[model samples]
Target: MTAMTPTHGGPWTEEEFLALGEDNERTELFDGDLHMTASPTPWHQHVTTELLVALRAPVRARDLRIHAAVNLRLTPARIVIPDLTITTAIDFEQRIVPGSCARLVCEVTSPSNAATDLVLKMHYYAEAGIPWYLIVEHKAMTLRLLQLQRGTYVEHLTAEPGGVLRMSEPVTAEIRPESLLPEH
Candidate 1:
């Protein structure tokens, strides 16, 4: 995907983009600019599904909600559709509504979006005051967890095959590396 700057055909507003509504097309709003993403690959879906399952244990009984690849509105000028998100909102139907609540926002690193996820997305989510942000990568088959502090994300922990990711405070969970990789 090509990086862009503000132009006549640039800087899409929330209303104009939302008006496009939910469609097969996957788009993201970065600095109020629109960027299109290609369809997810099998590896992406594999990681997404595994994350949903792993997070379920932590959320199901605690009444927290975790979602995958869902549209999320961060501000009037910005919106982020994360690969995974965890929220404490009680009313699922009401909270999942576009432009609503989010506590933890996660993104799996992909070739096209890695830089956005690692740098830009982290900045956006943290600036929005999201409590937790996770970045899972396939590099050498490892998963890295990042937590927000003082409006920025810092490395919280890392886990690889045969190891489990551990969290502290607001939430606690473990992510086995094998669980994230696509099955042969």
Candidate 2:
């Protein structure tokens, strides 16, 4: 695990907080602060599963690693469980180990998580130095890609159902939004 030295008033230590994730169902620790996730709706799981299938192929072929709903240690005490994430196998093992290293993070927006995904979680991922972030919206049937530059999201590529998501890092890949989404 990558060690982090907590600042004067930082959240709980990684060990102290992550230890709670095993039994807790709704709550997750983000940088030591607790964040409670609402029960996921069926739509959320459907999209998540579809996206996972789309991603799993490229990752498996290249032997790269990815995870689902896994806690990522953004810092010494700050941890966030992103819905889906991709990272290098080595970095994944060394920096995050049994948790996550999350070079690319994705979240399916739920009514309860839209603001957090667009605002709070966006800042947290940027601050933690994740290279890319993807937000998929259920209502609009859209996919948004954000690439980090200079500690902020500098590039954005958005597409609706028939649009293609072209990406070539962490693993070269393309995704047809419709194939990875449920019919409305």
Candidate 3:
């Protein structure tokens, strides 16, 4: 059984947060506190799986590794687990991947952590100098590509169900937003 550590209060150190995560898969350090989330709903997993399938070809073509939810060390104070991450390294380090090693980080948003994916992670990734960040919305079926420019992420592409996102910055491919939706 996993040891449960409470982190509701503010002001947490990196080591303390990691100790909590040693037994908790959902523990993410954000805003200097541990943010724990409930297990994702079926719909959230569906969207994440679909996106991974759609990205397979492009990911393999570039000789990059595609990983499911994994620890991403965005900063000393911020350690997040993005839904999907593409990295240039073949031998990816287990548990924590340095932000400098990631080619692109993608997060499929669930209601439980949409703000963390869209807003909080954006700032963290930008600060880490990560080149690209992708946000895939669960219900709306939108794929937003944010490219880091100067010192921040500038919106590159935002595609809805009918639209297609032709990515060219961090990676290159044509992605249809509608295909990401799980069929009823």
Candidate 4:
């Protein structure tokens, strides 16, 4: 999706963006501008929810935290709501979590917002110093686990529908990609 025009043309600060209130569409501050979108489909939510359940045990075992669709403050003028967020126990209290606090950020790809999830978010997450990023592509039936290396995310592991996604870094989890498919 193209970038949404701001309600107020701004290089708006974080406070100004939040002050827009909840009446508007789902909005994000990207490079001090607004990025808005309609509600996501159930397919997207299904993929996201299953991944969250799969990752929870491993993350909690390591004493870290996991959350769904929360505002992540990458910078004063840059805020994003990731599909899922993982952080160290220390910064879990902050509502708009500092990007430095993030260990992993996950995005479930939507047809309407594919670029944001598959491309833009990777750049943003890496720039925010987030060490890991996960993308679950529903149409493609694949899961990718990316790790930041030399300031860019490298696809460290990937699994197709039949394969189980296994991770050893950051946390340990075995997730079957096909299990996230929407029920017909």
Candidate 5:
């Protein structure tokens, strides 16, 4: 499906949002509004790739699927494209994955969208009852894991530069914050 030119005059319906299709631009629907962000930087892409590699073994062993940059429908009116997602629901035929199916959603922060990833998306993911949220901070070079507790996200782990983030739940993986950065 080709991406459609979005009309910005009014609130967007799910049908209208879905019809916009997929493209390089990151487009999301929040409360009948359309938000479009620029493409991620090379560093952002590198970190996502490294994290995907690190998580693949455990995810595959558990028979879960890990996808990068795909449409995730949090609600009928709330659709987002998460940086990475680990899920049990594997319906390749569907255009978007239901948020209910996600075991964990990850976001890698960029200077342009730090607030959105750290605050906005975190709240939405928690509100949707997603169990785990992971954030990879670009400038800080740290990895943080947040677990849903009482309908809010609380810090579960934070791995600084030389430190390792070891998690057995969601998926068994050990990641070093420095390992995710691209070589300069």
Candidate 6:
């Protein structure tokens, strides 16, 4: 299950896409098309790690599971790797988590994929009926919590650097945007 590149073209089947296997590149399948992005910067990885650490205890207390960089299957043709996901349970035998099981999905935006994370993924997550979406903007050093309302997302909270974001739904936790950044 290791491959350097996917050996197929557009309109790829799920089996073909999955066969691409584990690699350094960030690969996603959207409506039969393959989209690939560069590996995340070290800063991006650090932020995701810090957020995971901040969320683990509270999420675990609620008997939920939190995972980083896991495949989330929204539909037969659309599968994405979210930066972070909180779920009620994971089917260890399955290769992807169904969108229906997701409680919250988080994406930390890097310069290269800001638009996809902020706009495309947000819309897709909402359409799949995921309750919550969190976006962390790299350049702005801001965190935005969005709640799904009537098939669209509404901003519930926004925290800038030096500020704190506290939320009770999905999981009860306080996140400081600045704390996600690497120390100088």
Cand. 1 TM to true fold: 0.86
- Poorly placed runs, candidate 2 (over 4 Å): 1-11, 90-100
Expressed as tens digits, the lDDT of each residue in 163-184 for candidate 1 is: 9888653467877878778768
lDDT of 3 by residue, 18-136 (tens): 66645425777776877777657777777788888878788888877788887788877888888888887844546677777888899888776677778877788888888888998
For each candidate, give its TM-score against the true structure: 0.86, 0.81, 0.85, 0.92, 0.95, 0.94
Better of 2 and 4 by TM-score: 4
In angstroms, the error of model 4 at 67 is 0.6
Best by TM-score: 5
Q: Write the per-residue lDDT of candidate 2 for residues 1-184, one digit (tens) a residue.
A: 1223324365666776645535324445565666666557777888888888888988877777778777677766667777898766644333243333567899898876688788988898898888889888878878888999999986567778778878776666788778876678
Candidate models: Cα lDDT each:
0.74, 0.73, 0.79, 0.84, 0.90, 0.89
Q: Give the distance in Å from residue 6's predicted Cα in candidate 1 to where it truly belongs.
A: 14
Which model is ahead, 1 or 5, in terms of lDDT? 5
- Which segments of model 1 are wrong by more than 4 Å? 2-10, 90-100
Clashing pairs in 3: none
Which pairs of residues have clashing backbones in candidate 4? none
* Candidate 4 residue lDDT tens string, 42-149: 777778888889889999998888988778898887899999998886555555777777899989888888888888878888988899998888678888999999
Compare candidates 1 and 2 on TM-score and give the better one: 1
Over 65-176, each residue of candidate 5 has an lDDT whose tens digit, in order, gives 9999988999988999899999995788998898989999999998888998998899999999999999999889889999999999999998999999998879888999
**79-145 in candidate 6: lDDT tens per residue?**
9999999999889788788888999999999887788899899888998999999999999989999
How far is 25's C-alpha from truth in model 2 (Å)? 2.4
Error of 5 at 176 (Å): 0.6
Model 6 TM-score, 2 decimals: 0.94
Clashing pairs in 5: none
